[model samples]
Target: MFVLDANNPEALAECLKELNWLAADENIVTLTIPGAGNMNCVLRVDTGKRRFIIKQSRAYVEKYPQVAAPEERVVTEAAFYDKVREIPFLQGYMPRKIGVDVSNKLLAIEDLGPANDCTVLYNEGEQLSEETFTKLLEYLSGLHQQFMKNKVDDELENEEMRKLNHEHIFKYPFMVENGFDLDTIQEGLQSLALPFKNNSLLRQKVEVLGGLYLSKGKYLLHGDFYPGSWLQTEKGIKVIDPEFCFYGSREFDLAVFIAHLYLSGQKEDLIALVADKYEGFEQLNRSILNGFVGTEIMRRLIGLAQLPLEMNLERKKTLLDFASKLILNEKI
Candidate 1:
């Protein structure tokens, strides 16, 4: 298997040729890194005539090599695209699958030209409008409803990716010393770990949620549904990065989505509107959803995979307090 990067046009060109994407005379016009996903090496490749994305996953994380990952996760991502293609409402919201090379663990997909990820909302203090939020909820509703109470494709059941994500989302943030420098991200932020570490009740709740995350196989889920996975394009919101897709709690996706909205400083009513508009899943455990939301907030705020939020120390502490209450099933 040949490796390709932004600097290696020759390797990429050869790859395209092997995939039959490049004609005999055509060459790559430009190659650039697409986004901040940690799992894969995603590149935007532009030939003079057309553009597409080539994503390849390795045995370890592309962003953090020390963290081990399974190469087969890319195969699972490809399977997710295939399964969703049959669902009419979800077809338009996802990128078109062009080709997949299982032996090399690479995927060629249609490029959503000039679209930016929703992470920019947090990084730049932009807000998701009511209309856009509703659209997102609609997409999620369709996805959850389509597969609810049904047997998911065995090929799409991603246990390795879920275990990897489970560690990050459920276990790591509360650790006193996880080698992540919170002070570097923001001065004195390391002090915030005290409350989480000392609170036995909070840790117990997290353990319960983690158990459910691992054991429950209720509905098919886009396991890592967050701002980074959502793209804002001229056409509409496009969901990506289902490498962590699995059969898990339906509320897990919804909780993660709304947690980012809160962290991005969206209005209370807007957040409430999203919750009200969500018509997915026949049964939802509000307490469990709240626990997942709180855990997601904690992880993003202090875990290894950090977001570019513009919150000060005091505001972060406030959010942390709210997250704790939510996890404890207390009214906020």
Candidate 2:
């Protein structure tokens, strides 16, 4: 149940107005719970015959004015989901977008309350059955292929994206700049100091990422892909939260997905597990896993959104150590 705040009704009302969904008979109730992100409030609206999720975007999330809602990107999201529907292999892994109120940054998505979070699938000691895993791999592989097939070669692109990926996600995270808290991570570890001390190594990784990204053939990639972004239901698995999706390497997405699996300790033979499920996967996806896996680990570690495994030092010391070792060994 979502606790009603004074502003929630107003927010919902505004969103409905923006979406042209403000019907005299429709009843909308704001949820007491907020989503994990900084910019949105989730609400469940019962239209009697059906229900929908309303995500209202916020402007001043954490007093960051520049981080306003990317209303224009909502169009991108809708187009992506529409394209997702066309792929025969990915029929089960995407949601049917109902409507979008881009001006309000409000999205009306298919009600997924009845579906179970995929994280619960792992936590319950039930590995995603081979059937589901195989389906997922095929969907991902096909999605990447379709993305490449759909890209327009002549469109002029903005450099802001590249700058964001490099500066905010990579460079700023590792540096002891005003935005980052370097001492917090460095306090207990001396061996890990080599990364911070050697600027050349950091620059090399950045250059490597740029080169890998430039070789991209895919249309767009979900920069962040983990179980949390998926929900499994009786029908099948549906992916949500494509906010971080961008034009980049297919290996980048695959690596992040694998690392998330490893971090959760869901499977021992990671490559073998994915390889078995994704038929002829090696031909399509060789061990590009080696480079980006560590890059992803470090990106999550020191970056603004560090992994939960790194912060919870007590219970997940082993996981943290593993991540640390990967960061060191891979020099990410």
Highest-scoring model, lDDT = 1
lDDT of each residue in 1-332, candidate 1, tens digit only: 87868999888898789778788798998999877768899999988799999999999999899999989888888888898999878978889888888988988888998888888788555888888888888888788878766554454567777788889888888887778878999998898767785788998899899888876575778888777888988888898888888877788889998899889999888987865788843368889989999998988887888888878899889999989889999988
Candidate 1 at residue 68, lDDT? 96
Clashing pairs in 2: 2-31, 2-32, 3-32, 147-219
RMSD of each: 1.8, 5.1
Please give the CA lDDT of all the candidate structures: 0.84, 0.56
* Structural similarity to truth (TM-score) of each candidate: 0.94, 0.74
- Candidate 2, overall lDDT? 0.56
Runs off by more than 4 Å, candidate 2: 1-6, 14-18, 30-34, 57-71, 88-91, 115-132, 150-165, 182-199, 214-216, 233-236, 284-289, 310-332
Cα error of candidate 2 at position 98, Å: 1.3
Worst lDDT run of 10 residues, candidate 1, spans 148-157
TM-score, model 2 to reference: 0.74
Give the per-residue Cα lDDT of candidate 2 at 251: 74
